[model samples]
Target chain A: MPRPLTIEPNEKTILYTINLKTLFPVRRTLTEIFTRAPRRYVHAVDGISFMIEDGDIFGLAGESGCGKTTTGKTILRLVNPTSGVIGYRPRKQLLDAWRDMGYEPPIIDKFGSIDIAKIPGKYLKPLRREMQMIFQDPYGAFNPRYTVYQILEEPLIIHGIGETREERIDLVAKALEAVKLTPPEEFMHRHPHMLSGGQRQRVGIARALILRPRFIVADEPVSMLDVSIRAEILELMVEVKQRYNLTYLFITHDLAVSRYITNKIAIMYLGRIVEMGDTRRVLDNPLHPYTKALIEAVPDPDPKNRFRIREIPIKGEVPSAIDLPPGCRFHPRCIAFDQHPEIRKYCRTIEPPLIEVEKNHYVSCWLYGTPDEVMKLIKK
Target chain B: MSEVLMRVEGLKTYFYTARGIVKAVDNVSFTLNRGEVLGLAGESGCGKSTTAYSIIRLVPPPGRIVGGRIVFEGQDILKMSSEEYRRKIRWKKISMIFQGAMNALNPVLSIGDQMAEVFMIHKGMSKKEALEESAKLLSMVGIDPKRLRSYPHELSGGMKQRVMIAMALALNPPLVIADEPTTALDVVVQAQVMNVLKKLQKEYKVSIILITHDLSLIAEIADKVAIMYAGKIVEFGTAEHIYLNPQHPYTRGLLASIPRIRGEIKKLEWIPGIPPDLVAPPRGCRFHPRCKYKFEPCDKEEPPMVEVEPGHYVACWLYAKR
Candidate 1:
């Protein structure tokens, strides 16, 4: 029998990581092949680090190729990271097997934080129950052939939970009801193709929630749905979070939606987190130039502000991640670099480390100065 | 009001699918004036794109414009022959910038070659003259004229969108139809593209039909707004009238649901249900199922489009008797 898992005091961090990176090989051309060109890699996720607290909705925001999706997938172990330590506080059931093996579980420090990145494949199976993922495309995530019942039951079946078919069906019905797909039996026989985008998304949420996971990485869950229905799903997610005490790592490129749902947000640029803090603080008083540009770019839905062309300070396109610029990756298109000549030299020569500007607020820019000599570059 | 560039009346475009007849754009009517941006706003499958396509006479197969009168510059476009329309009115008079239009450019063709093709086919210009004209249009959209030599893949998403804008303006059309021009673009890039579009719109004094699902984007550029639902325009008026004083419940719900960047962050009151299926839309008011302000007549009677105030129109039973 598995040993009972122990809970630690003051362990707020559900998941924390340091300098995670994911790289993929680039395809070479014929001429390059003939010349025996050196291999190149696309730095998809480059040295990003952040902590997700228990029951917190941590938003990862960025444009395409910014690696927000990759970061989420890495946390769920869907995409293996090249390097870095991922500290995860596993649920009780997950650590039971390790305890049963008569091995002292690698619960480091008083907080019981274990480096999930170092865990072997055999141990990852039990841990999978505690960490689940919700994909962006509801249509593509589920099999067309599988009925809604089959789709929801597959996870429980694989995890060897709920011994009888009747027991699993009860759980499925309850999950369906929780997502407000009422009269659950009505949907059980229906296939994914029969469901609308919003309905399918609810099913996706129900599937994710079935395991009652401690942490979930939701990747652009509403980007594919209609705007009218997007809010419904978002509201349902918020309700579920409170009901289950689930920690969410919500990934999206949209700043508006992120602002509405997340308590904390981390803005990514070219695979690096440029700024992070309490959602309101980062959005209301953004210090990073990139963050400022992102906020200014959001089109205000008021005609009074029509034709009021605000000059976006940043110039040029996002630089290619393959041949990343020296020093700060954003230096090429950064407006602050041009405005403040004093910091330009530092920005162009050395990569600025992520440092706390205030309590919980962090930024990685030379304008904020080094940790030892923190400059009051941002106005209060 | 302001020289009408294009006036579409009683337009009906339907898709003959195996399931049923899909009323993609049913009885839609609107007018575009000179130098004005008319935004056709709606959720997905709300027929905003079909309305744009019907105006351009580009509605694809399985879908046909059953009835409509599209009058452009005092000429009935629906009466023109397909060949004549393609040769004369299309691009030369009214061009289109489609969603992900960047991908529409041939990968093998240079930006110069693509833009030059527009002139070659329409104006019967030589390659040299067309290239020169293309370069001019490129610069007009804020892109380097030298990028004419670059391939589509070489340019970023924003640059590619700009190239599409340049191509649309290559013939200097009086009216341009941009369908979700910045849908997939980043916020910063979207701003850049919108800036270029706004500047060029003012410079050229061209009327534009901007179709998008985002209300915020429409509020930024559109002078007039039409809120669509289930293939019908639920409300129509100037941007100020439609936004500041929305009479339609659907419009009200949409505006309320979007989270604002400024002001106090409040809990978004999301509309209850999904948009009606076009294949079998509701009997009367399509949005009644999700509308909180729905009345007894809403589910039984089709609401007529009524002018509540001068130039402000709404199609709802709540304001029907007013």
Candidate 2:
């Protein structure tokens, strides 16, 4: 007997549990061994992992140079990895086992394999349809010379989704409608320069959704838009996410924004995932020191509430990604470091592994160590 | 508590482009009190930048200040000679921390040379005297004096912003127009940059005209905020009054749009339409098309600024008494 899929009224969408892990280590340089190198070879993304269910919007947030973007692009197979695995359940299989195994693995497919990292320049076209990127700058995304219709139609033509001209036009119209650029006729013939910042970004969203890709990487999609129009775009994306049944890897520097759209959030620091868990848990009650600092940095809108805010003064600048420290990436600036001396020694000597603190909540701090006398060291 | 430092009345800055006459700042009026931080908040093309540019007479070619009176420290800055204005006002009495001014610094020259230029141009100080003052200024902004020798590229983005602040304050300017000071830096870096601005403003007693799109940022630093839309002031009030009780529809929309780190939104509501074109703005209220609470009077006639309470002003037909 076939099981019937039931839709519960007023019930939240049950997303497929997909816990993804992407780990890669950097090659040690002479400067690293001698401790006198001008540049440091810190693993930008060292053994970091998290999950985003089918209906869930996942957020990757960190301070600048924290490799939040790198983690997103790597999961989308935009960058080649030195080590570790990327797990995903897609509707179709475009990537083969060799590609998944990492570094110079053989081409498994007969028609010249499309290894996400090593795929030749020619094959990127088809692959682009499966995974698309929405950049931070709306104006920069489209060709200045191309009309709105042309920009939206390019993806449709490249994918060969429609056979007739009318079919393609219909697709473009639908894409525009999905992004809330209503009437479609008003904006189709206009150029990128003709539209405002908010309108131009809708065009960018339309172009990404024309192909109906299952997954998307929206990198600071509304950061550049006007204050009043930011919600309009976010609302449109949320609507489209349900209509298309899509999954997103949302990367942003703003903690407020990440919490707005995503259900699950991962906090990155110096190219490593410091913590990953439910959005409410991570944002409201952040486990890592870096996450706590980020949440505190957001300025409250209400003026009278300003003094009530527990502001954590972020001292000093982000340590250079090219040269990181020997200990926990956030150790130098972390306010909690002095209080936990027993945890401090190990954090400096060795990198902490991502361990599940509670159900569905994970952290990379040495406070929650293995069972038995880990507390004895703390007492001493 | 203090006298007004600068006053702008009936300001209109227009750019005569090939397409049409783009009215960037249309009939704008405001006053900056001594030791006050007035945040001019708006989206891009809302004429916030043009207002600042017009005040300083930095409006470039094809863009002319058609009608306005700019009174700075009891003198008409608009009517002053260019040479006199350059010598007395710019970088001396009323200076500006230009947006991305850090990028404007010469990459080849040392930070010391940049600071020295401001001192030499404004104060006519000797090279030796300028160097000493520059070192002191750098230390004041929390940077090490040794970094005076480093070029612009050698410093981080935050450091560059600090150096720009140091240079702007070299002449003891009473008022600094910071146009989007922290727009380019990261969140943490932004916090640091804003902290420096706040600290410097307190220590020096210099008034600031901060123009930015981020409401939360303005809320943190601004004593009073003026919301601009389609080249006009739509709402003006203290940051507390505006945030807690926004009277204008446009202002309300802006507050609702921002994603908060603390709150959870099931389905965020957005303002329905885009801002009107500044080149050919709407005949009545520019925001009438998207305003949810708009009345018929809003579409037929423009609303004049009305005081609903002490120190709180709104330009909306909904609030204005007939």
Candidate 3:
């Protein structure tokens, strides 16, 4: 009665997707909604689309409540998406075995792509082994009752990875060593309270690494730690990525940290990516007005720039996510919207699609022209 | 030279815990000229905030200003009676915009009512007069005076911080101590708040002690910079001197660690090891354990503050002879 879903191999991208939207409904009575109705839906992750290559450190950066965390959580299936598709391509070994079996994988499309968005809870359990998340607050993430050893051991036990108790302990110790919490025996018995902020974060990383997932989403990993210690943690992350052959979806509000670690970065504004490209290209030559404003707003450490009054290009605070402006979400606060009255009608009426303005660089702004015309505009 | 507004000499504020005495602010000294912004930069637990609290005499319990003098406007704050200090000096002369002070505002009370209380208590103004003054203060910080009736929760983070600034200046205090005023705010909002602070400093000519861990933020507002390490000021100098040519190893390490927006994306040279335990600080020099240029003398004897260049002072053995 039902058509079977199937997947075939297309060996280029690790994950590809179309419009991905995650909307949250605000509880309101029917009478209230019928009367002075405020926004019913909060667009937490609004129609965002991006792909992560294998082993690429993809950064998603935005201010607080901009849905950077939501995007990451959605990918890890921590929060289910409302609509759209997420095409996840597993490792070659899994693909080859599935092809040999001559079976159509449930939730997989015709082209060897598992639709992460459509996968039910029961099926998601196996997929969770390949994707894991490291939370923002290390203090909150861990169970206070569990010791460091027990905490790291929990993941391995849940996944049923190790053959015996001794094997699990060995794996836990190795994970701790991988995160550079040296002399694993010394830290094993200690509780979360016993560890410093940096040490606690390392334990969180160790717990995530214990799963040996292919893709890891690190949400504001270093923001909670001291500035001096942030670099060490970032360096550790890089080392672990190389050693484990892992891909990362690094999320942070601070661009400086993003620039330091990420290979590719996507700048989000009000739940949408405004600009996405290689870290160097995006930071050096930002196309979106929001991107330009954010870079300028960062306080330059050089004292020569002190007392030099540079006008802040944007105006007003980020608007409520629920009541986002009609077309361009940034239009209300955009400096360019005020300057270019000719394009104001277009900007206010139609949402701009992400366009490749340069090689591997994408920007979503009406000023840059439409998605189809963007390439020609750049050429001209 | 400008007139000195405040002079802190050998300011020692320590916390007496069960473990040991945490020497939070040990033998810290600096002078703030009138209308000049002096930035207090340090890592967490480095006692930068403690130093600010010591000046205001707001150090929490278990922590006490054990010794040293905090001379503000030629009067030793430590020597002053509690009653006298409260009446004459505290908010009337020196007000503090505390760390995370945006959330410090009373939630139930309107912004106008809370701000007015400062005027009512200090200036002994009527409710009506205080509210009017509060509205004026709100306008000064670029917030709509009409929103003075709104509660703290009603306003955004940036606006709440601006309200804190306005409240700090309500009594027209000549010296304001802002502890990480913009740390929790977004970068764009941070710039806005910084601009407001800069404008207030220029317009009202109030000396500010801006305490934050961010070096870039310090560069923006501070005329003079003091880099704290393990409860002691390792480096103290003009902002230009500190940024251009740092003398202390810790200061240099901090500068190098910060990833710049428009520079070559090289690996950040992070300082190895954590900040020393305040309860049992490292012997001789607290920073010697992590200092890259540590020598035999560094471990045996504490280095005294030496003037390397006219205005710049660094407490390190490497600069002792210079």
Candidate 4:
């Protein structure tokens, strides 16, 4: 059996150096499958790196098929990465438990961080309590056969939490109450179908929190919900984050939703992150051409601004990920490509490195220039 | 500009289900102008989609347009026979971008073949002439005419939706009904698609009835707005009047609930509880259970729609003159 997993207290500075190469064989003939021939690499998540400090809500904002969901799944090791380090500070609950028995886990570094990506398959069980995920579709996420009670209890049963079945039932009841599903008894026996969209999402959140995880990846948590219920669910998520001191990696395509919750935000294009910085700084003053197009593309609700019936900044839909452009992935659709003829060659041929264009604001674009030849082409 | 294009009065659509009759669209009344866009905004199962289906005379199996008059131009559409309506009205005068465009297109047929089918049947054109028209339509929607040979499966979701838009405008229908055209698309692509519709609406002088659950999208493109609640239109007015000075409790709740990209971070006030079941709806106001300002009259007796201002009409006890 694998050694019992335990670690030190989670405080600050959790680094993630994630480099993934996810390729799916397309247009394969019968003979190709038998021969095991390579077609083309999709490169869903190319070389990408970012840090999520403790208690941070990092927003991954992008359009469809941009690999935001893939990035989240990769961090949790739901999808194995070819290479990279996912350094995580273990659950504080386990630290206290391990301390009482007088033991120290050898895996922890000086910063008390563990590379979760390196952990083998069977050993991932203990780490489930440290991190969790909330899927986009509440309807399809849960098992149809399971009741609210069974849904919440299965995680506890897998991890061997709570001494008896009665104890687990009490824990489940508390989890329900925590999500404000009042009088816990009212919802425990109900199936997912009986509950409305909002109520079902509340149970999704409850299931995630029951593990007492320090981190949670909420993938479009409120997208499937109605507008009125969307806000209510967001409020609940915020309250839970504060009450439990949990960090969240909020993934969504809605910029307004991201603006509300995330402190730090990353704008992704195709697969690579085009821009990353403080949420307000990045959204309010977007740098990358892709980011600007995305921001302008977001349909504003303000009736005072109905003149939004302008031409779409970007030319067309994202091209095939497998047949990526040579230099900048977004050069074909970038408005700056036409504006700056001086850097047109570089924009089309040489991929620009993600460099700090401003304090805490990192951008990858030829317009921003290299670290040595830094130049701001389009200024605010 | 003041010309009234279509007027719907006391429209009632009911579904005779095994459980009971579900009054999907109950007494919904509105006017569509000649070349303006009207937004029908509501939550799911609130009967906004039903109203559109009723107008198109395609309210699926159990649902039927029980009582109402859809006066288009001058003549009442309900008075016309199914055969006459099919030959004259449908696709010739008014067309619809179905709610699910992804599933609307034929999988086996090429984009050109499907688009050409519209022209060949409706306009009595040859296959060659229809294909040429299809190419032109594709060009108008910003898709390459070369993609005509490609099947529906070959195109992206946005491209598939654009194909649907092209088909809707094939005959240059004077009026188009888009039921959540951008519902499942990415915001960027959604914005692009809406822009395409807006551009065409101006170029062809066609009025559009855009039915959607997103209020923000409505604010961007709609000339007039109608807020629906549990099978009833709770509020109706010009987009400016409705957004600037909303009177109905449900409307106010909806406006406040949306988080804005360009505004001060204010607390979103969401409406409490779920919408009532249309089969056995609340005796009075459908939204009475969720409205914070609901009083005795709100739940006891149904409130008649009253004109609070010049053009804005609201159905609520607060707006009703005693």
lDDT per residue (tens digit) for residues B199-233 in model 1: 88888888888999889989888999999999999
lDDT for model 1 comes to 0.87
- Where is the poorest 10-residue window by lDDT in model 2 chain A? A1-10
lDDT scores of the candidates, listed in order: 0.87, 0.77, 0.87, 0.86
TM per prediction = 0.95, 0.89, 0.95, 0.94
The TM-score each candidate achieves on chain A is 0.91, 0.80, 0.90, 0.89
Cα distance off (Å), candidate 4, residue B209: 0.5
Task: Report the C-alpha lDDT of model 3 over A1-380, residue by residue, as the tens digit.
Answer: 11111122356556755678899998888887789777488899998888788889999998888999998888878899999778887766544545565534564655467778876665566667788888889999999999999999888877678999899889988998998888998998899998988899999999888877888999999988878788889999999999998999999988988988999999999889889989989988999999999998888788876677656899888899887899888999999999999888868977877777777788888887743465454455
Query: Which stretches in model 3 have alpha-carbon errors above 4 Å?
Result: A1-10, A33-39, A92-104, A107-111, A370-380
Docking class of 2: medium
Q: Candidate 4 — which pairs collide?
A: none
Candidate 1 chain A, poorest ten consecutive residues by summed lDDT: A1-10
Writing each residue's lDDT as its tens digit, candidate 4 over B1-322 gives 4899999999999999998999999999999989989999998889999999988888897999999899999999988999999998999888999987999999999999999999999889999999999999999999999999999999988889999999999998888999999988987888878889888987898999999989988887888999999999999999988899999999999988898787677788898899888999998888999999989898988899999888899999998966
Candidate 1 residue lDDT tens string, A249-277: 99998889999999999999988999998
Candidate 1 vs candidate 2: the lDDT winner is 1
Report model 3's interface C-alpha RMSD after superposition on the true interface residues.
Answer: 1.2
TM-score of 1: 0.95
lDDT of 4 at B258: 90
In model 2, what are the clashing residue pairs, if there are any? A66-A271
Per-residue C-alpha lDDT of model 2 across residues B162-234, encoded as one tens digit per residue: 8888887888888898888888787777776777888888888889999998888888788889999989999
Model 3 clash pairs are: A6-A109, A7-A112, A8-A111, A8-A112
